[model samples]
Target: MADNLRGTSGPCPACGHVVAFDASTSTDMSVETVEEAQNVPISFTRPEMPEEVMDMTPMVDVVFQLLIFFMMTAAFSLQKALEMPPSDNQEKTAQAQTLEELENESDFVIVRIDRDNNITVDGEDAPSDQELLNKLREAKLGQLGQGVPGRTGLLVLADPQCRHETVVKALDAGNAVGMERIRLATVEDTAF
Candidate 1:
């Protein structure tokens, strides 16, 4: 049937051989427009497209979900923070005490961090966190808090060249064993 339609078949049993015809070859022009009319063609072909074309909507949705999940679970600052009481210049100045005064008093634990990052609790070495915690806990046995008040406290006397991490560790250890009134100061107040 297709061969017959395409005029490729042999002589027909009723009429004869087929003749090639084209509608666009019409000898007459349009009556109203006076222009040549083009033949509108009918097609049965499937549109051409690449075999590997993919939809990215699902992948994008999955990526967004994963990003949200990570944003929800990721830790920004996990370690506990110190509760700093809000104050003005007057209160801060009133609360401030020199390292010399702290040294003279028997109320402070006096953990010192030298330039070499060596930690000493009241002139004794505390080389590890556990030892530092033990020392701090023992020193702060009955102290409620620290300040200009006559309460016991932990004093961190650090050198200028000590690593910031060492100081943070000391402060964390102090906080871990409930040393609320923790004070930090440099070994010498003078700067080069």
Candidate 2:
């Protein structure tokens, strides 16, 4: 069957004689002729390359525009704060005073708040908030007249049973009278 397919037993039309032809041999001869040509060495010369070019002007312009837009739209605020000036008459160096010296100080004013929410100055009952403020002002004035070297200190003595609102009111009154050095002292006395 293969010989018939390869035309090995076929008769040639031109010669009218029995001719044998192998299809595989003819295909192999064509392939070998192409491979012989491919095995010959050939030199390869590269074409000249064009110069590379890149423009960054547009990108840089866009970046600068974005920066300018943000700078123009950004909000800047000036912060407000309370400025305190140093006291010229007071000594700059702080001297630590003992508890005994503080207790024995004659210039210290005591503001007491009892459990009943009653305000007192130096053990004397103040009938109203106005009266307390007036007393605090008088103490400030007295200290200034006496040529006190520092600010007048107000010691707030609040009973443990006193309401927080009452204590705040007492502190507000002291602040209203311009008392800077206010200290809180809690007393454990059960008596109102």
The candidate that achieves the highest lDDT relative to the unseen native structure: 1
Stretches off by above 4 angstroms in model 1 are 1-53, 56-75, 86-96, 142-151, 188-192
Q: Pick by TM-score: which candidate is best?
A: 1
The lDDT of each candidate is 0.68, 0.66
Q: For candidate 1, lDDT tens digit of each residue in 41-115?
A: 224369997689699999999999999999999989886688775766676557556768988777778888988
Q: List the residue pairs that clash in candidate 1.
A: none
What tens-digit string does per-residue lDDT give for candidate 2 at 1-192? 232345334444445455444456344333233234334333345888998888899999999999999999999886433224476667768786654465457666677788777888766778788888887787777743344444476777788888998888777777777776677778755633
Candidate 2 minimal-lDDT segment of 10 residues? 28-37
Question: Looking at model 1, how many pairs of residues clash?
Answer: 0
Q: List the residue pairs that clash in candidate 2.
A: none
Backbone clash total, candidate 2 = 0
